[model samples]
Target: MKQIFAFMPTFLLSVIFCNAQKLTATDVNSPEVTVVVDIKVNPQFKSEVKSLVPELSALTIKEAGALSYNYYLSPDGNKILIIEQYKSLSAFQEHGKNLFSGPLGQKFRSSFTVNSIVVAGGNLPDSVGNFTVMKSIGGFNSKCE
Candidate 1:
């Protein structure tokens, strides 16, 4: 028992060291930042935001070096989650420069209180369970058929 106890610490330390080294490598190879935007829309602007979803979708899809672009509306319809991944910092910079410069972007921006926005995982609800119940309740309609 004593031998096992003494060896466990060493084993744990070795494992942690290996993980730290792996994280360093990952940091070096990964993008400068991965932005998770948690946009809280005022109750009055809920419909306005929904109306611009198509334009927002188009803008994000047109971005170069975009890895994953996902937007989700909160169950209460007062907040939005925007998860956008980029290959590099420059890609994000380019996205920002064009986002507010185009007509589509301008129109989309006109509908929001930007200051109300918060970072994802900040002042948000618990994430342990499925945040969207509609996923399970989906497919009731036969639009495809």
Candidate 2:
């Protein structure tokens, strides 16, 4: 039992590291774009924000260029991190336009205050608003089975 306990952390780390994927040259050269957004939910509107995520995700995924759209909430439920991936920069721009203009967008705006945004994998237009831009150095993504 003691021997098993001593090996647990090493075993777990090896399992995790072995499963990790690395980006290939082809992946790096692709026109894919990724965006991560951080927001703070208004205390009074936490429930409203939670309710909106499903609908927002559904609509976002239906876009032809959408690769993935997901949201993660902090343990206290006051913070949200949104990760979005698109086939190309144009696709991401189109999605952005729709996100800030529709009824859903109106509801979303009232629910949270955007804290910051980080864009990676492509050059973005100035019209997209303030954001930190980053180039992919090394990363990996596994395709859905």
Best by TM-score: 2
Model 2, 1-145: lDDT tens digits are: 9989999998887667776644444355567889899999989898777679998998798789999999999989999999999998889888988788788888888888999988888344434557777766556664322
In candidate 2, which residue ranges exceed 4 Å CA deviation? 1-26, 122-128
lDDT values, one for every candidate: 0.57, 0.81
lDDT of 1: 0.57
Distance (Å) between predicted and true CA of 137, model 1?
A: 38
Q: What is the TM-score of candidate 2?
A: 0.75
Tell me the TM-score of model 1: 0.54
Flag clash pairs in model 1.
Answer: none
Model 2 clash count equals: 0
